[model samples]
Target: MAHSRGKRRLRTLVRNGWISDQHGAWPMVILPAFVGAQLAHRGSIAATADTLAVIDPVLATSLPITWLTGFLCFTAIERWALTPKKRRPSCLPAIITWGTIATTTGLITVIRSPMLLLWTPVFLPLFVAALWEVLHRRPRSPLARLTTVTAASLMLPVFALGVVGAPSPLRTTPELWRATAILGSYFVGTVPFVRSMIRARSDHRWEHASVLWHLTSAVLILLATIWGAVSWPIGVLWVIIACRAWAFPRWQRAHGPVKPIIIGMLEIVLSIVLSALIILA
Candidate 1:
């Protein structure tokens, strides 16, 4: 009976260590990469008739998959690292397994496209800040959240570079940075909007901050459209989300706390819509 109970306990620890509880982060991880790749593919096709002929089929397919796998493993390790030190010993197996996978996949990706190394300077600071936050057990702090979100959104340009075969000097077009700004702005706004709903639900200050951020995002989007960085259609999409950021908190307060699952599902839909609009634009 003792041995059986010990086995069950070990299994529970392993399960907990391996599975991430950050349900909302999945879209943040995926959408930018997909949008980046799609936009790059479009740009390449427009640039030349023989775009597909030049793309390495294996590298084109494998890079994103490998990068994503490494990222997921790194996320798992981060989660495990956040657990109480006393309990961390129980989670070491899972942590070691994920760490090894992350390192291996990351090495393979960098080796395949050494030009990706150019991004190291941009990403290293963000990684350090994020690591500091995690180590300090403040992973959910606003600064930490923003750091992670910015890094994820910047993957837009990185994935774009990857798709176009990592040119020398790592040149990124205005379109890539424009998409990054749009996506990054939306994600940064979500940090406050989500907090207003759940963590700081009673804090009127967070509500105000959320509304103000959304309005700012709307104005920026409008300006981008006027400057021809984005189309009117993309600007229109921003208006919709800005209105959502304005309305949802009021609705939640009038009724009651919406289930987290509902909030997560709605965010997924919004992310999908945002990605589609950017790609189409």
Candidate 2:
């Protein structure tokens, strides 16, 4: 009976596009989450550990639940948008998604982390805009994609602040917003680079523009790091991104398109490296 129930759950996840097809979404959430948590702990995992020492591990562990909640929330909205308009209500996915959201919110309330609550004001409008985009079934516009990716990037710091028990934007340090920009730059820059590489490959104008965009991004990140807006390690990431903008597309030209799985793996590695550096910074 338990085995059959597990199979049913697995089938539901697969039917809802929540399984392997969604692998690309994880790093987008994970990296920023790491950056936020690290920033909240001031780049020290030990600091977070020391602070969480007094708190319940259940709450500490609920960090991942927040990530799941965010993903489910977005996925639900997407699914809701995709559902055909029928007079007969057939909204099982939406029901499950809302159930998950409610359960996650209960856990968060129990945890008593206010950082996430503070961020909700900023997160809600962006989320609604995403829903609107999907509802209209418009092709993913660059600006909309950028906005969504940038919003996902912010989740990390918010979750990180919660992990370290930082209260409701009480401190408002330079590091707070700096972390967001530093992380936001990399993910948002990918929009142009990706366009130049895969989507707009034959368009010379866009390709050149993409290269220029990445180069400018690298230079700006370098200037910001030199100005001490963010740590030097993050600047290293920009250098790599700049090189990717210039080189990765060429490699793809010769190799005939890198597999999505391979790209996802590389991104995971990049995320790990970034997280490690921030933790040690």
Candidate 3:
């Protein structure tokens, strides 16, 4: 019997050492479990944050249970999903995609559903991963093909919703200029970096241009005004970094050095910025 392309590719990857029969396959079970838990944990995460914000904006110290579920969620993904041996094998990004929803649900518990109201962590990381595929890798799995289609449909909308659904704090002017600029900065600035080589296709120029442009674009996004009220610059940028989800695979497929390094640097900067802005804000 002829195997389907997916089975054939998995066979190839397994044979060539691109993947393995490993515990990463646990996501088939773990993902479904997390989705169920998120339904119950959602209210718990929200109520805890809403109630606690009064004592201290920081809420650094709280009852153990208050922080318990969110911490469990975080630790579960960071520990199990990022397991080194399991990282390269199986489909970890999809697992992380689910975790992003889990992260948002848990966070909504604390911030009253408006904190990052418009933002959905699931979009950028996964979309960028797909974009990286468009730019670099070949589609191997049916799910991968489906995800790429889903991503293409959602890319502009993700940024568009992020622009439009920007809350009252982010939209004081009654006009969308601020939000537009903010989204523009994130979109135009980064998209070019992603496509710079493809568009220009130069040798040394791609290297220097990617670094310079990536830094400049990232800083602008971090500092970009969201109607001047929504000032969590670092956190906003940090999500961008976390969503730099495609950088590695793109590098593997394209045999390019610049984009991946630029992507890695942005991921680091955004991660730090997100943590600092959200925590300290």
Which of the numbered candidates is closest to the native, going by highest lDDT?
1
Q: CA lDDT, every prediction?
A: 0.76, 0.64, 0.37
Q: Write the per-residue lDDT of candidate 2 for residues 1-281, one digit (tens) a residue.
A: 99999999876664453442356566777778766665555533222333432333544567667566656656655554565666113445554765586577646754576445777678778777776776676426665676678778877666656665655454445555666665676667666766666667776666677688778878887898898875787788778867877887788888787666666676567667766665565
Name the regions of candidate 2 deviating beyond 4 angstroms. Answer: 1-12, 17-20, 41-59, 83-91, 94-99, 102-107, 204-209, 228-231
- Residue pairs with backbone overlap in model 3: 45-109, 46-109, 49-110, 234-273, 235-274, 238-270
Model 1: per-residue Cα lDDT over 37-153, one tens digit each: 887677742233333334445557666766665565656567666777777676566667766766775676677767778888888998889878877778798878988898889
- Winning candidate number (TM-score): 1
How many clashing pairs in candidate 2? 4
lDDT of 3: 0.37
Question: What digit string (tens of lDDT, one per residue) describes model 3 on residues 198-261?
Answer: 4444544543444555566555555544435336554355345424423533453478545545
TM-score of each: 0.86, 0.75, 0.27
| Cα misplacement distance, residue 64 of candidate 2 (Å) | 3.4
lDDT accuracy of residue 22 in candidate 1: 78
Ranking by lDDT: 1, 2, 3
Cα displacement (Å) at residue 191, model 1: 0.7
Off by over 4 Å in 1: 1-15, 44-53, 168-170
